[model samples]
Target: MSTSPVTLLTEDDSWEFLRTQSVGRLATAVGGEAEIFPVSFAAGDGVVYFRTRPGTKLVELTVNSRVAFEADEWGEDVATSVVVKGTARILETDAELAAARGTGLVSFQNDDKNVWVSITPTEVSGRRIARG
Candidate 1:
């Protein structure tokens, strides 16, 4: 099946797709090489949130905030995917942390104790397999 590029998702579609999925892959550069990590996330108000432990990748995210994230689902002969390119920022404020915790979508047990990262998408696109 082939797919076509559509305009950026509407607010409703974006929120719906994001809320339906619990996990996504975050793509970033590590040591000048591409790296992708699967993570559980929550989305709302045009921002995607997730938590991660301190490490080199986290440091890289802090230093270079640009990233791409993708989530998708597939079935027999059909698939749909969404990609978001955005700027990431570590959530530091009590309000933001509280909001992140409110997502209630954490897969990891110690998510609340980990550092929360939030991505505000500059662009978002989605595609679905064309019917044959």
Candidate 2:
């Protein structure tokens, strides 16, 4: 198999690509082990938001707010990956919930997603792997 050359993506390109995606992996590290959860998220206003039922993610985020989020788009000939380093927090205000109401971020599974979490990014970067 032939591998493609990797190119670093610009900040603007990265953000634009992220805005076009709705899902990403949220990586969190607790005491000793690290976990990654697939999340259905919305990209807007320099932050990403997602809904989840109360579980490990909620528990872990409560313990450590620092987290990393990644989303990627891939094709047979090219692939793009974006990494976001941010702080995760549960949305607890009426205004926050009100703003998140119509983001079109829907869950793929049949779980009760009552808790809303938002990841505000401190660093945003990306790379593209393409055949040259």
Which TM-score value belongs to model 2?
0.90
Cα deviation at 23, candidate 1, in Å, is 0.8
What is the lDDT, from 0 to 100, of the residue 26 in candidate 2?
Answer: 95
Off by over 4 Å in 1: 1-11, 108-113
TM-score of each: 0.83, 0.90
Q: Give model 1's TM-score versus the native structure.
A: 0.83
lDDT of 2 at 52: 89
lDDT of 2 by residue, 7-56 (tens): 88898888889888988899999997899999988887777889988889
Return the top candidate by lDDT: 2
lDDT of 2 at 83: 97
